[model samples]
Target: MKILVLSNMYPSPAHKTFGIFVKNQVEALKEAGHEVEVIGITNPLTGKKNVISKYLRWITETKMKLIFSGRKYDVIHAHYVFPTGLLALLFKKITGKPFVVTAHGGDIDRMAKKNPKIRQWTEKILQEASHVVAVGEALYQEINEDYQISKDKLSIINMGVNRDVFKAYPKKKIRRELQIPDGVEPVVFVGNIIREKGLSELVEAFKTVKEKRPQVELYLIGASRNQAYREELNQLMGTGVHFIEPLPQKELAKWMSAAEVFVLPSHIEGFGLVAVEAMSCHTPVIGTEVGGLRYLLRDGSGVLVPAQQSARLAEAIITVLENDDLKQQLIEKGEQKASENDEKKMIAKLERIYQQIS
Candidate 1:
């Protein structure tokens, strides 16, 4: 099948971890014998002027591609619902082809709530799409209840873990490769370093944990789009915290493997993909009981704490670090959970969806 993928978030040279799941999905589809073409926004710049110009250029490029590409695609798949789906909707209307849109959390939880106009557009986009994929079960329920999208048209399908790249490695070897010192328990977080990701809360929690276990170190690994927020976080976090830039998947997998525990304190997440990757690397996860994390970490798979509660977050971290039995149990269960969302299975499910719609 020939597929055209439209996504507003795609990895650039500078920000390779940004929207990396979308790139992985595209590559998986190609390996499965499907022809795929992508039109994505690769710039990781911020600021009002840059944002406006970036979208303007993206719109112009998408319009040209739809107009001039003589080879018709079997289906159009969009990542985000509002802005990116707008282009897929346009192509579908002009050519009478079916389109699918995957709602990756913020589009519904944040973007749709921004204004009445965007909310209305998001609803229309979901309504018009041939199928909709919600990356988490909570998102599936939200779209059904809040957006009034039919259950028949919506499915819960996470961007699964590539076990081949994320599998467990010897902790000592991985730590040495990454230059991580021995005798220090590293608690790692891999996502955008922003306020919404609960970085402030994580820093405060880590401070409490560090006092109890001086050997524990916190690693914040990802790009910081907001300069002011980054500065504020830097001020809040003193010694014992390492701010590393976003890394590619292979390197990130090594960090995950080397860590004592992986933490994701996001206020909202469509799906905690990083947590699953950590699980695949035999690293236990500690996440907030919000959004996808609630579903992902349920039933002894990983430790869960309330969002914004540094006290609870600190307690969970300490418990995981101190109790060897609990940590081992979490690792075993987390690996099971990760196996259920394997990339090969996910791509096959996606292939079936494309076939059904086309």
Candidate 2:
């Protein structure tokens, strides 16, 4: 099988975290003996005032890349619905080949409503695609209901995890490198710092957690996309709550492995790939009970609190921290579930999809 992956999220050397899931899936397909090529995207924040220039640049760059190369492949696996999916749909029109699409939250959940024209394009392409991949059950439902896409065409395969990187690391060395005291209980929040991610609630919960255990430190490992929100968050942090930029993927696994608990208080998540990585490291996760998070924690690998409920988030964190037996149970269950997302399993499933579609 030959596959052409279309996504804006493919990781560049400058930003390894970006489009990593797309790269992982492509690798899985390739390891299954399929050939893979990528048409990665470039997303420039579209201003209400500058929408024309943004679209022109996007279309021009994409057209030149796809038209000039004229690559041949049996499978076109498009990661997002709008630009990537739309572009692939056009490529198919020109090349007369089949394609598959996977919607990873933002396209259907965020972009669809914000811009109706893009939504129309996405739906038309999805309606014509060979197959549709959903990251979780909620997203599966969301895609089906939103577009009236048939259940037969849809399947859920989560983003793969690198178990080798996420597994238990030398916590002492990682802590020393990050300059943290060993005795203090450290909890990490690792994602883009934004309101939708529920960072404010994490800060509030951390304050409550500190009230009970003063030695506890909250290490936030991300930056805000919205600068005004960054200013807003800056006001909430103090000596106990430390903010840092997102670490490299390899170093992040060490940080995840070192932490006592991994917290993701997002209001929405297509899939909690980071949470899976933490559990793979034998650390318990605490995530919001919204969107794809329910799918991630359904097996009791982690604890869930009502989204945006700072009090419950605080309580869940405290319980996971203070109760040793529960902590151990979560770790055991989480490690088991984490193995299910291994690259080998993901590759096998994707190979089946490629065969079926091609």
Candidate 3:
């Protein structure tokens, strides 16, 4: 099958960590024996648009790309609704192809709520689509509650972790390399530093956790998408809180293996990719109960706390830290569950989608 993979979410040369999910999906589709051509876009300014250019570029580049591509695609798979869905919708009208829409979280939750115009565009795309895919149940419900998309049109495809790459490593060696003390228990949070990521709340919780367990260390990984957010977090850095920018995907796996506890306090997440990656490395995760975490994390894997509740987050951290046997049990169980969501199986399901839509 010849597939045209459309995404306004993908990593760029400059910004490597931005929506690597689309990139991962594209590669998976190709590995499944589907001939895929990507029509992916990155923010030219990396999300600092002056408003006028943001709207104009969507029509100009996104719509224009489909019109002039010359080669037709059997399946048009659009990732995230904002610009990708809009462009895919326009192409569907022009070429009469089977369009598939994938809803990422912000589009269904925030953008759909704030912009009626974009919401209408997204609904038209979802309603008319041959199929829809969402990474999480929250996003699936968000789209279904507001739109008239049929039940048959939707499916869930988890973005899987590469287990071999994230498997267990020498934790003591890693800790020594990073100069972290043997006595300190490192609680690692891996994701972009943004408003919705809940890093500020993580810091607050860490402060309280420090009051009780002085040896408790907080490690903040990943790049800060917002300068102000980075600055706000800087005050807490190096005072039992260590800040590190985004590392290569390979290095991140090593870091995950080193940490005693993994925490993702994201207010919104389509799928907690990093959390699962940690689980694959036999690291116990503690994430917000909201979004895809509820579906991905069972009771055996880790603890789930309410969103934006730093106190509960802290309590959960402490609970895991105090219980050595529980931590080991969660790690053993999480590793077993994490192995179930493999790229090969996910790609196989995607192949079926391609064949059906084609």
Top candidate (lDDT): 1
Model 3 CA lDDT for position 102: 82
Alpha carbon lDDT of each predicted model: 0.93, 0.82, 0.80
Clashing pairs in 2: 8-41, 9-19
Model 3 lDDT tens row, 108-193: 87777787787787787788788898877777776667686666778887777766677877889888887888887889988887
The CA lDDT at 41 in model 3 is: 56
| Candidate 1: regions farther than 4 A off | none
1 or 3, which is superior by TM-score?
1
Q: What is the C-alpha RMSD of each candidate to the true structure, in Å?
A: 1.0, 2.2, 2.2
**Which candidate has the top score in TM-score?**
1
List clash counts for every candidate, in order. 0, 2, 0
Candidate 2 positional error at 120, Å? 2.7
What's model 2's lDDT at 357? 74
- Sorted by lDDT, highest first, which candidate order results? 1, 2, 3
Q: The CA-based lDDT of model 1 is what? A: 0.93
Regions of model 3 farther than 4 Å from truth: 44-61, 236-238
